[model samples]
Target: MKEVKVEKLLINYKTLEEFKRFKEYGHQELSMLEDLQSNIVENDSESPFYGVYYGGSLIARMSLYKVDKKYDQYFEPQHDYLELWKLEVLPHYRGKGYGKSLVDYAKGYNLPIKTNPRVNSHGFWERMKFQKATYEMERDFGQNPLIWLPEGISERNTQ
Candidate 1:
């Protein structure tokens, strides 16, 4: 298997245009476009989006956000954690390890990770050793969250 490099996507027209190939393009992307149009965001600025490119085209992508411990509700130690979202590999790229590469990149931070996996993706998260987080009606609302714990960390017992 080839090594995949997950790169921080730049906030620019080219990156945004590349994003249109992704299935999850929606409000978040549109907001970025709006920001660009209004000069609210500078070209080549840092973005939360990261992705793997194959032959110079984005084939997989995910967004990772670091949540402050003050708002953390998923870890036993109440420490800062990464909230991962929109992990998607293009249909042609599925089963090729690009998705795993992105997840592994996030895990490299060694911080606990929380993600609301898309429907039917539970198996993939499970394979990555993430476990279902105890659901809190008030904290979780309608989303089912899964979490990955690094060494010396554990999921908060919401029970």
Candidate 2:
């Protein structure tokens, strides 16, 4: 496998088409298409979505959204953190480290990161050193959240 490069994606027809192949395709893709066509977002605007292409085809992808410090619920001192989502590697590309590479790119930011991973991905997140936050009935309702904190930061008080 060749080294993969993670790029911030643009909302274009091609990108939209490749997105259809992923199981997570739904509101997010629709929203981007609407935003792009209405000029609410420029065609090549910087998006939180990132992906790796194999031979001119996008095969794996993820999205990372930075949360404002004021709204942060999972880190001490209320610093900005990344919320990672929609991490998927095509079936044919599984086990080749594409998913791991996308995750590693998110880690490169060196910020506290959180993800409500797809149910089947627990082992992958564990291997990536992510740990489940201490359960909070109110805050974590209906979701199992996993998080990674860079050295200087800390997990928030879930109470």
The runs of at least 3 residues in candidate 1 whose Cα sits more than 4 Å from the true structure, single-residue gaps closed, are: 24-40, 135-139
* Best TM-score among the predictions, by candidate number: 1
Stretch of 10 with least lDDT, candidate 2? 29-38
Alpha-carbon TM-score of each model against the true structure: 0.87, 0.84
Predicted structure 2, TM vs. truth: 0.84
**Which 10-residue span in candidate 1 carries the lowest summed lDDT?**
29-38
lDDT of each prediction vs. the true structure? 0.80, 0.78
Backbone clashes per model, in order? Answer: 0, 0
What is the lDDT, from 0 to 100, of the residue 42 in candidate 2? 57
RMSD of each: 3.2, 3.4
Taking the tens digit of each residue's C-alpha lDDT, what string does model 1 give over 1-159?
878899987777777777766635443522333433343276666678888999999888887889999988777878999999888887878998988999999999999999888878999999999988884538676778888999998877767
lDDT of 2: 0.78
**Candidate 1 has what TM-score?**
0.87
